[model samples]
Target: MSISRRTVLGGLAAAPALAALAACGGSGGGGTTEITYGYIPDFNGASLLAIADDRGLWEENGLKATLQTFTNGPLQIQALGTGDLDFGYIGPGAMWLPASGKAKVLTVNGVGQADRVIAQPGIDSLEALAGKKVAIPEGTSGDMIVQLALQSAGMSLEDVEKVAMDPSTVVSAFSSGQVDAAGIWYPMIDNIKQQVPDLVELAQNSDFADVMQFPNVMVTSATYPEENEATTLAVLKVLRAAMDVRAEDLDTTVELTAKLTQQDAEAVAADASNGQYYTAAELDALVGDGTVETWLTAMNEYFEENGKIEGETVAPADYFTFDLFTEAGK
Candidate 1:
C-alpha cells in the first residue's frame, strides 16, 4: 500500500492546494532548490547535519538549504506537515509519524545507540527499578530504552515512579541521588557517570537491537519525496559526502559536532565512539539486502504494540522512500 500525504489527507482531493503552496517555496536561482532543513541540535542527532552545514556540503551539492534547529522531533514533524520544513534529520522516537502517514523516513542516517538506562549501582537490572524514582524524558528515544528494557524484565513504566525531566536535569537528579535510575542519552549519560562513580547500566538500545532499531533518520513530509525526487536525491548525496568527511577526519568531525551542538568536545568525544555511522554504500547494502526493511518493520511493530501508533499497521514500504537511497547510490 502506498502511503502519501494524499492518502491521509483525503487523496488527490487535497493535493493541489498543498502542492501549490509547496511549489512556491523551494525555488532558487541557478537551477537550485532553496529548502528549509530541520535538525535537532543535540550532539549525536545533529552530528551529520552539523558536519554537512559546517563543511558547506549542502551548497556544494547544488542546494540552498536554510538550516533550522528544532528542540525535538515532534516539532519537526509538525513543521513538515505544515510545509515549513523540506527535510529533517530526526531521531527514531518520531518514527511513529511515518507509520501514521504523517511523514516519510527517507534514510536511516546511523545507529544512535547512545541512549541508556542507568541506575545507582544497587539497582542492578531493569526489573530492579520497579517502585524506584526514574527520571525520563517522556516520549523520547530514551524513554523507549526504559520501556523496552522494562518490558523485557516483565515490567512497564507504570511499575516505576516516573520523574519527567529534561536530559540535563535527569543527569543532575540521578547524580544527586534524587532518582534511583534515569533514562538518558550521552553525553548526559557520560556526565552523570562521572559523578555517580558506580552507576550500573541497566540497558541500552543495542541490548534491545534484536527487537527494535533506534537510529537517527532523515525524514520529510509525506508529499516531499513524491514531488521533489531530484532534490531529495541531491540531499542524500550531500549526506553521503558528509559521512565521507566524518570518516576521513575523526578529530575535525568531533570538533565540528561539538561546536555546532555547543556541547563539550570531551563529552562529544566520549559519545562519538558509541554508535555506527553507515556510508552510502553501506546504507545501500542494508536496503538492498532487506536489513533496512526488517529493522524498520520491527520498529513499526514495536510502536504499534505499544499504542504509540494507531490504526492499521504500516508496512515498511508504505513509509520508507528507500528507492531514493538506491538511486542516490547510483
Candidate 2:
C-alpha cells in the first residue's frame, strides 16, 4: 500500500516498459477472447480485479483479461494511446488531458466516487493552508481536487505553497512536518490519518457536488472500441457482473479488496460500504445527462484559467464514448 517516491518518479521513465507489458497478449488458453486490462494498485481497481480473478468472471465471459498495472493515470493513458491497453480504469481528469488529442482513449463506464482530497490536522479552514506547503501530484485527480477545494474557500493555489509531490512522498513529507497537508486517496488517506491521529480531512469530492460524481471510469483505445465493439460489450458485461458481485456480497468484496490493497479487512469493508461504489443505473444517468462532459469542461476551464492548458483547448466529449456502455445496457 505504501508506494515509494522513487517508484512514482520512475513511472515517467518506465512508460515504455509499462506500455510494452500492456501490449502483451493475455495468459488465457487457446481460442479464448483476449482483452488487456490496465489498473493502478488502489482499493477501487484492486477490488474489481480480485473479484474478477477470484470469481473467474472474465473467463466465464470468454474474456482472457490480462490485468496490467501502471504507476499512475498519466502513464496509463500514455500506454493506452499507443494501443498498448485494450481497457483500463483511470480518473476522469487523466482522460481529459489526453482527450485533447494527446492520447487516443475513450471512457466506457464510471466506476467509483472521487473521494480524494487534502487532509490537514487542525486546519478547520482552507485559509489555514495559506503560506503553508501543500502536497499534490501535478496534473492528477488529487491536484484538481485540491484546486477545487481551495476555490470553494474563495482561495486559489496561489494561497498555498504548492509542493508538487507524488502520493507516496506526500506521506513522508507530512510525517516529517515538511508539508502542511497532502492531497491523496484511500488506503493512503486512511493510512496517513491513522499515523497522524490529529490529521483531519480538509477537503474531499463531497465538498464539490458537481465534481464529486467524477468517478473512476473504465476506458479503452478509440481504435479498439471502434473495431471491436462486440468485444468491448463483452468486457462491459464482465464489469457489470463484477459490480453486481460487489453489491450482493459486501463482506466478500471487502475481503478481496483488503487482500489486494494489503489493508485491514475491516478497514477495507468500511471504505467499501462508504458510498464510493456506483450502481450501473447511476452511471447511466451520468452519461445520459452529459454530466461527465460538463464536469470535464469545468475542469478544463479551471486548468485554462489557471494557465495549465497552455494555449490549447480541450474538448471533453472527445475523451469519452458511451456507446459501449449503452450497448451493454441493451
Candidate 3:
C-alpha cells in the first residue's frame, strides 16, 4: 500500500525526470529552480495553477517549473513521499497523510461541492443501484460523497457492489460498460454524459453533503519549505497571482482549463461556480479566522469515522500554514 518513488514513477512517466532535479534554483545564476508541481486533470482545483504556468509566471519568478498532471491526489502524494515532487496539489485523502506530518499545506487551492453519483440510463433511483457496481476513486473525497448519497437513499455501501479504482480509469470503465454506476466529479461527469448521452444523475453532492470539498491544496515536503524559505515565498507569489485571475477573470479561467484539459468549457464553468475561489487577502482571513482549520478537522474526522485511516487525529493547524502567503504579500 505504501507507494515508493519508483513505483509511482512507472505509472506517471509524464512527470519530470530525476535528472531534472539537479537543475532546481533561481535562473539568475545560470540555473533556474527546477520544480515539479503535480495536479489532477479534473476541472476543479487545477485551473489557477495551470493559468500561472500558461502565463509564464513561474519562470518570471525565476523558477524552472514543470507542471505534471496526475490521475488523483494520492498518486501525487506518493511522488511527494519519495521526494520526486517538490510541491503537489493534493485532495483531502492524500492531504490527511501529509497534513499530519509529511508535508505542509501552503494554501488551500480550491473548494467546492465537486462530487456526484452518475448512473447508467433507466437506472433512475437508488433501488436500481443495489447489486450494481459503483466505481469511485479509493481514499479520495468523492468516495465519501458517494457513500453519503447511498445512505440518503436508505442503503448502506454494503447494499451495492463497490468497485475502487482511479477516477480516470472509472470514466473509461463507465464508457466501456464495465461499471453500472460511477461516483465521479465534473468535468468527468460532464465528459461521460457527453460520451454516453443516456447517463442519469442519481444524486448531487451539494444536496446531501454540507462541507464536501474537492480541495486541491498546494503543499511542499515539510522540511522543504523551511529549507527553501525564499523559494517557497516565490512559488506562493506566482500562485497568488494565478488565483487573482480566477477572482478577476473567471471566463478566461474556464477557457484556459477547458483548452488545456480538452474538457467542455461549459462543464468547467459549472464546476467553478460550485466553489468559493480565494484571493491572497481572503486566504489570510480563511486561515487566520479558523475557517480552513474547521474544514480540515471535519475532513479528518470524516475519514477516521469511515475507517479509511486508523490512527489518532491531529489538529488541522498541524498540516496547514499561512506563512508563505503572509510573506508573499509583504
Candidate 4:
C-alpha cells in the first residue's frame, strides 16, 4: 500500500515537535537549511535521529530538519522516489529497492544480527531440522537466516516442512508445538524464550557473519547528494555526532529514542542492545577497507538470486557513496 505523508502523520500526535520548512529553500541569508527526513519507527530505526534531535545537533549544524516516521523501509523508499523526503534510514531488506534508482545510501548506521533460526529443545542442530516443520515469516531477514543455516548444514528449504507464519503468531505456534522450529528475530526471540524456556537457537545471523552481513543504512534521494553536497555533509556530521553520543551514553540515548518512538524503555533498550553500531572512525574504516561495500554487495546478490529485485541488479558503488561521510568526520 502507498502511504502518504498525511496518512502517516494523522496518528502521530505524540511525535516530537517538527521544524517548519524554510519557504525560500534549504538555506539562504544565513538561515538554517530545511530538510524533510523519513525514518523507521523502531528503536534501532530511530536512535540516531532521535539522539540528534535531542542533542540539538540539527540546529547546531544550521538545519531546520523535520523527522517523519514510516512503518517500514519500502514505504520510505516510495516516499523518496516521489521526492517527499530528502533523506531516510532503511533496513537491509529494503536496500535492494534503491537499485531501481529511487534512492542512494549514505552510510551504514548499524550491523544488527537480529535474526535467528531457533528450534525446539530436542532439535539441537540445524541438521536435525531436516525433516522438522519450521515456522518462518517468509521474505524477512529471519527467512534468510533459515536459508543460510540450512545451506551451512548441506541442506535446503526443500528438506524441511516450511510453515509460513506471521512473526506475531510464530511464538504461539511454536509454543503449542505446531512447528518444530522457527526462523525468528529479536523482541520475538525474547518472548519465545519466555514461553518456551528450552528453545534451542540453532543459528543466528552472527553464526554466518563471515559470509553474510546486513547493515541498516542512512540514505537520500538518488539526486540529493549531487544537488546538495554541503547540506548532505552537514546531516552526516550531525549523525556522526549522534553516534558519538550513543556510544558514550547509551542510557540517555535509549531514553530519548523511547520517547520519540513512544515505546517502552525496556523494550527499546533490549532492541538497542541487540544491535551493532559503529563510531565515526569505525564507519570510516569499514568504508575504507571495503567491508561495508562487501556487506551491501552480499545483500544485493542474495536478493537478486531470490528474484526479489524488480529491475537490473546494481552493485554497491551504484547506490552507495561515502565521500561526504568521510568529509563529515573531519
Candidate 5:
C-alpha cells in the first residue's frame, strides 16, 4: 500500500482547513517554536505532556507546544493524518495500520513492552483459555498482541470466543467470569488484579521480548517533516529532553502524570517504570530493521493473508521515515 505523493498531498488538502490550523501556529524566532500535539489518556501521553509543561522542557528548546488529548490511538492517528496533530503518542498496532499507506510515522517516542494478558483465577496458561471466552478491545494493539500470543501457543481465534470490551470493563468482565482472559495494558492490568485477587498473569509482552518490542511512538503526517522539518526536529528535541528527565526523576514524573490522568502516583509510576525510555541511540537501535519496520511488515502480511485489507501489501518504509529522527538525534 504505497500511497503516491499525489495521494498523500491530496489527502492533506482534502482535510478541513481547521485541522491544519489546529496542528501548528506561530513562527520560530529567538529560539521559539510552537507546535500542536495530540495525545491520549495513559501514563505515556500524560507524563510526556506533563514533563514538557512542568519542567519547561519545551520552553527551554524555544518551543511553545500545546497538547490536545484524544480518546485512543486510532483517533490520534486520524488527527495526525488530517494534519490536526503535529505529533502523537500511539501503539505499534496503530502505527502499523495507518502507516500501511493510510498514515505515516514521524518519530519514535518510547517502546511499550508492557502489554498484559490477564486471566481469571485457576486459569494459569494459554491452554486453559480453550473453549472459554476472552475479552479485548477490538482492533487495538492489545487485541493484536492477544492474537499473536494465542497463535504462539498453537491456538486460534476459533478456539475461543472473543468479546469486544473496553479496558475499563475488563475488571468487571473478569470478576463476573464473563471472560476467561483479558488482554489489556497497565495500570488496567494492575487495577484488575487488585479487584480480583484470583486474577492471574497468563502472558505479557515481557515474555515475548525476543520476538517484538511494542513501541509506543510519536508519529506525524508525512508532509509535516517535509514542510516543517525544523519545527518537527525542535519538537523531538524537546521530547528527548523530557524523556531524559523522566528517566532520572521517576517520582516527580509519576506525580505529574498522576495529576494529569487523575490516577494514583504509585500506579502511574509503576506504568512508567515498566516502559523502556529511548535515548537517540536507543531509538536508532530499536528501529534498525529489527524493530518497528520489521514488525509492521509482518503485520501487513498477516492482515493481507487474513483478508483484513484489499490488495494493499505495504512495505514498512512506505509508512515511516527514519531521517527526521536521525536528524533530531544530532
Candidate 6:
C-alpha cells in the first residue's frame, strides 16, 4: 500500500500535475531540506526535537528543521498526512496510522512515562471509571495506555463513557469537573495537580506494567526518506546525538522542554524522572530485530480489541522503515 504525494494530498489524485508542482517546491529547489518538525509540547523525548532545534543540532547536521508545536499527537498526525509536516517526533500509538503506510519510521527515539490517568475527587480507581465519562485523545498512546489499564480492572472501553478530546482540553476538562477522569500527557499532568490540588491520581501509564508502552518515534513521509536519504540520515544522527546530550544534562533538557511547552522547569524536571529513555545500543537492537515489530503488533491488536482501529489488523513491519536507522548508525 504505497502512499504517493497525491494520496497524501487526500482525494487530489485527479490532479496528477500537482505532484510535479510540489516536487519542484519541496527541497528539489536546491537548498537544505526545510523540515517542519512537529511535536507535542509534552515533557518527553518527543518534544526533545525542539531541544535539538533550539541547540542548533539540526543545522549542525546540514539540515534546516523548523519546530512546529502541537497541542496533541493526533493533530500532528493530521499534518503529516496532508504534508503540512514533513517530519515528526511522534508517539507510537499515533505513529501507527502513518507507520501503516503514510510514512516511514526512522527510529523509536525514546520510550517514556508521558501519559497520566487522573480522577476527580470522588473517582479514585479504574473501576470507578466504568460508567463515568473519561476524557482522552482518541487514537493516541495515552488512549492505548488507558484502554490497557482498564483491562487490569477486568474492563474495556465499552464499560466506560469515553469522551475523546484533545490532550490540551482533557486536563482542563478533568480539573473543572467536566469529566470524571482524564488520561492526559505530562506537563498537563503537572498542570492539573497545581491547578486542582485535590485531584486524585488513579494510575500512571506505568502502573499497567508490561501491558503498555508509550513510545515516541521519528517519522518521515514514505517517499521523503527514499528521495532525500542523505537529509534523513542527517536528521537521525542529530536526534540520536541529542538523546545522548539529554542524558548527560538533565537540568538543561528540562529547561528546554519547559521553555518549549511553557511549563515550569522545576515542575518539568521533577515529574520527568518517571519515564524510560533508550540507550543507543538498545535503540539499534530494537531496530535491527523484530522487537519493535512485536511491540507494534501488540499495539495494533490492542487498538483493534478496543475498537480504536477498524478492519483487519495491519502488520507492524508495514509501519516502519529500519533501513534508515541502520544507515544512520553506519
Candidate number with greatest TM-score:
4
Worst 10-residue stretch by lDDT in candidate 1? 1-10
Q: What does the lDDT come to for candidate 4?
A: 0.78
TM-scores, each model vs. reference:
0.85, 0.80, 0.78, 0.89, 0.82, 0.77
> Which pairs clash (backbone N, Cα, C closer than 3 Å) in model 3?
24-34, 25-32, 25-33
Write candidate 5's Cα lDDT for 109-171 as tens digits: 676766777788888899888988899766555676788789889998888888877656766
- Lowest summed lDDT across 10 adjacent residues in model 6 is found at 13-22
Tens-place lDDT per residue, model 2, 1-330, is 524211222364122212111212222432457767777655554566677777877766667766676766656656777877777766645645444555433443333443465555677777788888888876666776788888888898889888998667887777767888777766566667666777877877667875544555666765676787767777776777777777678689878867765577876665554345655666677778987667667766666765665335757666555656756766
Candidates 2 and 4: which is better by lDDT?
Answer: 4
Count of clashes in candidate 3: 3
- Quantify all predictions' global Cα lDDT against the true fold: 0.74, 0.64, 0.70, 0.78, 0.66, 0.65
Better of 2 and 3 by lDDT: 3
Clashing pairs in 4: 26-33
Clashing pairs in 2: none
The residue-level lDDT of candidate 5 at 110 comes to 70
> What value does the lDDT take at residue 171 in candidate 2?
75
RMSD of 3: 5.2
lDDT per residue (tens digit) for residues 1-330 in model 1 = 001100111112111110111122222434656777776655555677777777777666677776666666767778899997788766777777788888888888778777788999877877778799999876677778888989999998889999987666777888899999987777666667689888998898789888888776888998988898889888887777777777678688888877766667876777778778877777888889999999888878878877888666678798898888788767
* Residue-level error in angstroms, candidate 1, position 259: 3.6
Query: What tens digits encode model 3's per-residue C-alpha lDDT throughout 262-296?
Result: 67788678867766688877887877887777778
Rank all candidate structures by their lDDT, best first, as comma-separated numbers.
4, 1, 3, 5, 6, 2
Give the lowest summed-lDDT range of ten residues in model 3: 1-10
- What shift in Å separates residue 215 of candidate 1 from its native position after superposition? 1.0
Superior candidate under lDDT, 1 versus 5: 1
Clashes of 6: 2
User: Which residues of candidate 4, in runs, are more than 4 Å off?
Assistant: 1-29
Task: Put down candidate 4 lDDT per residue, 140-256, tens digits, no spaces.
Answer: 677788888999999999999999876667878998889999887777778878878988889987888998986888889888899989889888988899888888888998899
